[model samples]
Target: MKKLFHIGEYFQEKYSQPLQRIGIDLALGCPHRSNGGFGDGCIFCTEDGARARHLTRVGLNLVEQVACGIEYVKKRYGENVGLIAYFQSFTSTNAPVSRLRELYSLVLSQADFKVVIVSTRPDALPDEVLDYLEELNEKYELFVELGIQSACDRTLQEINRGHDFAAVKNACARLKKRNLKVAGHFILGLPGEDFNDWMYTADQAAALQLDAVKIHQLMVLKNTVLAQRCNQNSNYVKPLNEYDYAAALKSFLQRLPENTLLMRLMGDAPESELISPRWWMKKGQFLSFFKEYFYSDNTQNGNFVLTHTADGTPTLYHPRYRQHFHSLAGAGSEAEKKFAEPSALPERLQKSASEKRPLRLLDIGFGLGGNSFAALAHSEKVSGCALEITALEFDLRTLQAALNLYNPNSKEFNILQELINNGFCRCGNSEIKLLLDDARNTIRKLPEKSFDLLWLDAFSSDVNPELWSQHFFAECFRVMRNDGALLTYSSAPTVRGGLFKAGFTVGETPSFGRKRSGSIAFINMPQEGFVPLSEKEKHIIFDSTAGVPYSDCSLNAAPEKILSQHKKLVERLRRRGVPKWYREKTVKN
Candidate 1:
C-alpha cells in the first residue's frame, strides 16, 4: 500500500493505452572528448549501442534508428502500446543542448511516441539541459536515469566512473527540484566492494530519497576496461558465490527504505560480452537462489536501525530480531525439547478411520523440507487420514536438496509418496504435494478457501519482511477456509499484529521444547462467545508499538505510522508478563 512504483510499473501504467519502446542509437560519443580513443568510458561500458546489430543494419542516424526501433517494439510487444523513444547510446545528453533538443524532437514528433527516457551522467546536466528536460516533462512522461554506480567515493574511483561522488548528490537534488522522477542505477560486486559496501550503498540511496533504484551484479564485459583490468591482474575481481550474492542482496533490501521502488534486483549482460563469473550465465538459477534465501532468512526492510554520524551517514550496529527458530532435527533428544514440544492435537482431531478424507495441509517456506517431513509424520498419526501436503519452497536447489534428503525409496518418502499417489498413506496416514516458488507469489495462485491447515514455518520476520507484511498475510487469509487455523513458531509482536490484521483470532499457545514458552495461533473466526482484545491483550499491542490489526484489504498502510500509533499499547503489554526476548526488540527510532 506504500505506492510501489518500479520503472516497469510506470511504463505499464503510462502506456495503458498502447506501449511501444524504440531504441535510438545517437552514435554520439562521450563528453570527455578523447582523440579517436572510443572515450574508453567506464570499465563496464559497452559500445554495442545497447541495441542489437539488426537495428544498426537499417541506418545509424536518429530518424532511421527510431524508425527501426518502432518496428521492433511493435513486432515484439504488439501494436497496442504507445512508444517510448529510448536514447541508449553513450551518454545520451553529452551533445550540445541544441543538438539534444533536435534529436529528442525528431522522436517526439512521431504520432505513436508517448514518452522519452534519457540516460545520462550527472556531470553532463547543465541548467540549459535541465530546462529542456522540464519542457520535455511538460509535454510527455520523462524519466531521467542516472548511473551512480556506488555511494563510496573509493569504490567509485576504483571503477573509473570518471565523476566525483558529489556529482550524484547534486544530480539527484536538481532532478527533485525540477519535479522530475529520478532512477538511480547501482552495481554490486564492483572491484574492491564487499557486502558492507553494498549495504552502505542502499543506506545512501535511502537517505537521498531516490524514487526508484536499479541494482545489477557486476560482470566483466569482454574487451571492456574491466576485462582488461581483470586480465592484467587475476585477482582484480572476484565473483560472488550465489549464496553470498543472495545474502548481500537481502541485507541491502533490509536497509532500503520501504517506499523506494526496486526497479530490478538483477540484470543480464550479453553472453558474448561477459567474461568472469561464468555462473552468471544462468540467470534463472541466480534468481532461484535469491528466492530461496528470502524464504529461509527472516529480515525485513528497515529491520536494522542505522546509528548515524553527524553528517547523516549510517554506522554499523546490532540488527533487530523479529522471529525465533525451533530445531526439528533433534526432536527426540532433550536439546530438541528445549526448542519445540510434541504435537498436542485434540483427541477428536487425532488420527481416526472416520475422518477418511486426506488431510490437507499447507507448509509455508519449504526450506530443507524439514517441516514438510514433520507434517507427513503428523498425518501418519492421524489414522486413515491422507496427508495432502502443499509444501511451498522458494529455491529450486533447496527443494532438490530436500527431495534428495527425503528419498521416495526411504520409509518416510514412501509415506509422503503414498499420500500423493493414492490420496492417503496408511503408514503415515497422510498426503502431500510440494509447491516450489516464493510463497508470497505462489500462495496467491492457490484457489481461495482451499487449505484446511497452514504451517507458517518461514524464516523469522526480521530477515524476510516482504513475506510478513499485512499485504501478504491477507492473501494467506483469503486462501484459507473459514474454519482453517494457522500455526507458526514466531512470537514476535509484529507477526502477531499482522495475523490479527488479517482477521485472525490470535492467542498464545504453549511452545514445544526449550525454544520459548509459547507460539502464536490464529483462527479464521473468533470463537462464538469470545471477547475481543481485553485490556491486557490491548496493552501488548500498545507496549510493542506493534500497530493495529492490519487486514489485507487496508490500503496505503504505512508501517511507521502504524507502529507510532500503537506505542502505548506496546508499552502496556511490556509492563505485564512479556517474554524477555520479545521485550528486547525495541521500536527502531
Candidate 2:
C-alpha cells in the first residue's frame, strides 16, 4: 500500500498538540430542496427538513452537544484537550451576518474551543459572508470547507446540486483571496462512475490549489432518491461493499496530490438513518483501520476573542463592528438590569393575564435576543397572558445561533426554539412573534397602537443611527398603545431629541451600561418611576448640533441616506448664526 500523508500528524506538528475536531450540527441545513424551484439537494443527502433546524431542535443544544463531545474526548485523550469547533452538517453560511456571528461566537466563548472549521456549500459563499469571514480570520485561524461532492459537472448535475464546477472554482478563489485555509469535499464511487471518474475528480480537485481535501465513500441513505432507486434496482445503485469501498477510497487517495491535507477519509450516518451496505464500523474503528491501511487522525482558526468581565460572563468582540455585543459590566447582568427591569416588562406582562388582554411587545433590533430572553426568564415567576410579541430584526440568523445555546431539555429553550424556527413561539397563553426583516420596513406591517411595551435595544446611536431616527420613532409611536412605554439603553442627546420630537414624553430611567441613565418614553406621561429631563440634558437635545437627530424620510431608507440628510441639516444650521443655547462644541463643528 502506498503511504498517504496524514492530516493528524500535520495538525499535531503545527498546533503542538493532539488536536480533535468536535462536529456540531449548525442546523442551518441545506438551502437546496428537492421540491423547491431552484433545485434539489444531492440525491444521496438525508438532510430532509433540516434547513430550519433552529425551529425543530433535534437532540441536545449545540453547547450541550459540544460539552458531551468534550467529555467523550477527555475520556479518550485525557484532560486539557483543546478542540476545533467543526460546524458540520448542512450549509453553515446559510443565515444572515448577525446569525453567523452568534453561531461562531458560541464556540469562541468557550475556552476549550481553540479553532473553528466552517463547513459550507460551494454555491453559498456570498461576498458579504466572505467579507465577514475575512475579518474574523484576522483574530482566529479560520478554515473553510466547501462541499464540492464531485468535481465532474455531470455528476454534480446528476446529484441535483444547484451550482456547477465553475461556481465551486470561483468560491474557492474567493476564500483563497481572503487567505483562508480552504478544504474541498468530494465523494468517491458516485453512481455511473468508475475508477477513471474518481481520477478525474481528484485531478480537478488538485487543480483548485486547495489547502486540504476530504472524500468519503458514497452511501445511499433512507428517504433519499438514491435509496428508493436502490430498493427498486439494487444493481442500478451499486454501493461498494466494505472491501470494495476500502479499495476504491485507497485508489482515490493515491491519486490525490501529496501536499493536500486529507481532512476526512470516510463518512457515516446512524444505523437507523442509513440504508447502505450495513458495515457497522464505529468512527474510531474506521480511523484506526485507516491508520493501519495508510495513516492519519487531528485540528486551527478562531473568529471572536472572548473577554470575561466582573461578573464572569464572557462578551464577544465583534470583528466587523469593532465593538462588544454585550456590556463590559456583564452580558447576563446587563440584560436583566439595563433592559428587562427598566422596561418593567415582567410586571406589565403579568398584569395582561388578569386584564384578559394579550401583552403586545415590540422588540427592536433583536441582536442576540438578550432582552427578550431576559423577559422570558422573568416571566417564569408568574403566569402571564398571551404574549403577542413583534420582534423586528434585520438578521434572522441569530435565532439559529441563540437556539443552539440551550438543549431541548430546557423548557424555555424548547418554546423559544419553536418560535425561532417558525417565526412564532407558543407556550400556553404566551405567544412570541418574530418579524425577520429590516425594522424600518417590517414596522409598518405591525398593527397600529397594538403594543403595550417596546424594548428599543438596537446598537449604539453612532453605530446604528437609523434606528434612532425620527421616522423610526414616529412609526414606533404609532404602533404603541396610549399607555405603552418604550425603554432603551441609549441616553444619548440625539436619541432623546428623536424621541421627544416624535411625540413621546421622554424620561430618564436608572443609569446603566455606557450611559448615565437609560431612556424611557411614553405616549401618555407615567404617574411614577419616571424623571423629567434636566436643563443640561434639554440644552443638548434642543440646541446642540449633537442633538440634530437622524431622519429616515421614507422609513425604508438606508442608514447612509439618513446620515447624509442629517449632515445637510447640520450644514444648514451652521450656515445660520450660532444660537445662544448652542454648545461651543457644536459651533466649532
Candidate 3:
C-alpha cells in the first residue's frame, strides 16, 4: 500500500513538540512561458504566500531551502522534532523531471525532517514527476497541494489561472491513481464569483474525491493585478461580508466529504498588504464576528440555499421571511421576549440553587459571545459550579470581537476572557470554557458523549444547507450524552426531519419571546414522555417527497437534484397514507 502523508499531518509529526510551520520558496517559473505568464499570476497570488519577509528567508536550492526551514522550525519549536519543508513559492513542480528529482532528493536528505510537502499548480505535474514522487513516498512522507480556485471556468479565467478545468481534473486523476494524497486549495469571494460559485467549487472538490481541502477568502493584495483592477473600477472587486463568509464556510464544510481532512478554513493576509475589503484586513475581528453570529441558540443558514438559484445564482426566494425577521429583531419586543426567557434549561435545573454544580453546555455557533453571556446570566441564578461551555464559530473576526468585548475590569467579562485566554476557563465561582472555530469542523475534536446541553445556533437554513443536513445532525447525536438536549430556533419541518433522521427525538420547547410557536429541541435519546412518530409521521420518514437524501458538504452537487430526490421521497410518503397538514386544512376550509 502506498503511504500517504497530508501536509498538515507531516507538519504535526515534524513539529510534534510544538506548533510551527515554515514556508520555502521554490522560485520555479510557469511551464506556459519561459518568462512569467500573463496577468501577474492568479489574482489571489502574493509574493510571500502572505508571510512576513522578516520571518522568512530566500534560498537558492532545495538544500538551502530545507536548511532554512529547519532553522526556523528549530527556533520556534525548540528542536524536539524535525521540520516540515513546505515548497510554497510559485509552482514547485514546473521544472524538468530530472531537476524535480534532484530537488526532492536534496530535501529528503535531511533525515531529521518528518515530511516534505510540495505546493504546485495542477497543470504543472508530469508523468515522470509522478513516478519520482511515488519513489519519494517510500522514504519520506509526501503531500502535493494543488491550487484549484474554483470549479467554474469563467471564474477561473477571470482570475487568470492560465489552465482550464480539464487540467485540474486530469491532474487529480493522475495523483489519485498513484495513491498519492491530494490537497485541494479554494479561494472564496473571488472577483466575479459569489456564494453560488463557492458552493459549486466545494461540490466539485468533494466529487473529485480529494483527500483533503483548504479554503481561503479572496484577499485583494496591494501591487497585485486584482488590486489594480479594483483601483481602476471600484465595483470590480466584491468582498464578502463577515456574516456571508462565515455562512458560506459553514455551508461549504457541510458539503465536504466526511472523510476529507480540512487543512484550513481561512487564511491570513497582512493588513499592510491588503488594499480592498478593509473588513478582511481585520482577519481576527472578522473571524470573531462569524464565531459569535453562528454561536447563538437558534440560528442556521438554511435561507442561503433558498436564496440561491437552481443554477447557483443569487436570488430572492422569500422576501417575506427576511422582512419578518428583520422587523422582529428591530422591534426589540420580539428580541427581548426571545432572549429574556431561558428556553433550553432542563426542568430539574430550572429552580436549582446558585451554589449547585455549574451547567455543562455546548454552544454550536459561538458567534460573538452573546450566547455565552446569556448562558452566564442564567448560570448566575442557578449555581456557582463550572459552566463547562464549549462554543464553536467558523470566523476569526467574531472571535476577536468577543475577545475585545471581554472586559478585564468587569468581573463577568474578565472571567469569560480568562476562560478563552487560558484555553479553558474555570469561572471564579464556576467552570466555563469557550472552544473557538466552526462547530462541524470541531465536532469530532471534542470528547464523545460529553455535552449536557447543546446550542445549535447557526445561520438560517437557506444560507447553510450543509449544517442543517442529516450528516451534521448525526454527528451531533454522536457527541451528545444520552440525556443531553439540543436547542435551536429553527421551526422548519425539513430541519426537524433532518434532526429526526439523525436519531434525535424532536419536539418544540417554549419560545423565548412573544412568538406564538416555540423553538425546536432534540434529545440524544427520546425521553419517556416523548411522543413516537405517528404512523403518518413514520410514512414521512420513508416519504421520498417530504425529505431529500441529504447531500454531504460538496459544492459540486446540484441542489435541484437533491431537492428532486427529496420530492420523490415526499411523493412516496404521500402514497403511504401520510396526510398533508395543508391538505387537511384545505378540506376543512
Candidate 4:
C-alpha cells in the first residue's frame, strides 16, 4: 500500500541504513542569474539557495567537496556511512552535457556516494541534458530535482522565478519519459498569494507525480530583494506559525500522491540566515510537535487515525474496529466509483432534484461524510434540484478529527467545518440533517418512503454488524421511495441476504477501478436494464453458512448479543436441513 513516507525512512529501508546527503556546490551558477537568463534570481532567493554562502570560502572543487563532505558525515553520523552526493549549489545542469558528465562522473567515482542529486530550475533541463542524465542513471542513482515553486504564472512572475509553469511541466515530462527519478521543491508563503494559491501549487505538484517533494515555508532571508519588498509592504510576508505551517503541511500531504517521499518539511535555514518567523520553536522542536501531533488528537476521537490508501486519497482508519472508512484502493475515488457512480446517483439525483419536489437522500453510518460530500459535488449544481439528506452517525468525533487534520483551505475542510458549525450544511436546495444517536433506532424515525436515493454506507457486516441486520435493512426499506435505489460498497453475502429479506430487488453495482462488483438494491428495479447479481453470489446468499445474517429486532442489542441470536437461528436452520442447497438428499444410500 502507498503511504506518506519520510525521506529518511525511505532511504533507511532501501539502503539498509540511513543515507546522508553531502551538499556539493558545483559553482555552476544559474541560468536565471544576472549574467544568464533572468533578473537577479528570485526575489527571496540568494546564493544560499544554490550553494551555501560560506562554500566559496572553502574554495573546494566538486570532487574535493564530495570527499570533504564524506569525511564530515563519517565524523557526524558514523564510519562507512552511505552518502548521497547532493549537487545543491545553483543549477547543476547549467553547463553543456560534456562538462555536466565530467562533474557528475567525478562525484559518482567516490565509493561512498550511492546516489547523486542534481537540483536545477525546470527551464534549465533541456532535452540534451535529460538524455545525458538518463545515461548517467544506468551507472549511478540520479535524481533530477526541480525548483517549481508556483504553478500560477502570475505567482511565478511575482517571485521573479524566470520561467512559467509550462516550462516546469515540459521539463518534468521530458525527464519522466527517460524514466528519471525527479523531486520538486516548493516554497509556500510567496508574496501576494493566498491559501487558495498555495493549494493550487500543491495540486499541481501532486499531478507531476515526482519521486519526492521538498516543501517548506518560505524563509525571508537577509540581503535579498524580498527583504526590501517586505519592508515596503508590511503584509508582503505573513509567516506561518506552528499551527499554520503544520496545517499547511497536512493539506499538502493529503493531496500528495501515494508513496511519494517527503524530502523535507522545513528548509535548512541557519540561525544567522533567517530573518523572521523565529523564536517560538526551532525546526527540530517543531518537528517533534509535528510528529506527535498526528497521534495526539486521535486519542480523543475514538482511535481514528489518518492514513492514505493506494490511490493517494486520505482515509480514516478506526483502530478500535480495525476498519478503514475507504477502500485500500483510495478514499475519494472509491466513494465516487463504488458508491456514487454505481448507483447512477448523479444522473438520478440531478433529475430528481430538478423536479418540483427535491430528492431525499439517506446516508447510513455517515463516517466523516465522504459519501455525502461526493454526492454533493455532482448534485449540488443541478438546476432546480433540491435535496434533503438525513445522515445517521454514531460518533461525531470522527468529523471533528477530520476538521483538525485537513487543511482549512480544502473543500473537505470547508464542508466539515460547515457541518460542525451548523448541525447541517445546505448547498443550493440540498439540506443535510445529522443524527447523533444509534442509526438502528434513529433511522426508524425518519419519514417512510421519503428518500429517493439511499447510500448504505454502514460499517462492514462482520466488523460492525448491528447496522447490517435484517431489522435495520427493513427500516431502510421502509424509508426508501418506491423509485429509490440503495447503493453499498459491499457484496458480502450477509449484507446481500439482509437486503433480499427486506424486499429489495438486489442488483450488482457495476465494476469500477480495482474493485469488480459492489451491491445495490432497488425498490422496484426491472431485471432488463441493470446488472444483476450472478447465480453463485445469489446461491451463497440463499444457502451458505455466511448467509446467516444478523438481526437486531430491538435496535439496541449489543453486537455480541446480535451474533448469538443469529447463531441460534443458523443452528436451527442447519438442524432442520433447510436451504435445500445445503441439505443432503440421499435415496439409494
**Per-residue lDDT of candidate 1, residues 1-589 (tens digit):** 1233455666676566655557676666666435432556777876553444557656667666767777777788777757777666667887778998887888677655677778778888898999999999998877787889899999888877789779999999999999887878888899988878888898888777877777777877787788888998998887764445566777776676766766677767657766856552267756655555555523332222222223332222123222222342232232122212322332213533366555456778655445656555555555555656677766544433333335478875564444334533444444456665667668888988877667776656545555666677788788876766666766666777777777777665544544443333445453233234445554565444554333223434444544443455456655785432324346888
Q: lDDT scores for all predictions?
A: 0.62, 0.73, 0.62, 0.78
lDDT of 2 at 462: 71
Per-prediction TM-score, please?
0.51, 0.48, 0.49, 0.51
Ranking by TM-score: 1, 4, 3, 2
Ranking by lDDT: 4, 2, 1, 3
What ranges in model 1 sit over 4 Å off? 1-5, 14-20, 49-54, 280-410, 413-589
lDDT of 4 by residue, 218-317 (tens): 8888888998888888888787755566656766777878889888887656778778667355678667766765436445766565656678777766
Q: Write the per-residue lDDT of candidate 3 for residues 1-589, one digit (tens) a residue.
A: 0122234564565556543445665556555432463225776666444332533454345566556666766776686755556676677887888988777666667546555677888888889889988987776667788989889999888988889778899999999899898889888888887778788887888888887787777778888878888889988867764445666777776677766766676666567987755552256655454444444321333332122212332221112122222122222232223332433453424533343654567777665455565666656665433566776766544444444334558764565556546746655454555566556667867777887677776666655555677777877878887777776766556777788777777766545433533344456454434434445544544443444435444423444555555556667767876644422124543
Q: Model 2: per-residue lDDT, tens digit, 64-104?
A: 76776777778888775668777776788888888988977
**Position 501, candidate 3: lDDT:** 76
* Candidate 4 colliding pairs: 50-89, 50-90, 353-385
**Predicted structure 3, TM vs. truth:** 0.49
CA-RMSD of model 3: 19.6
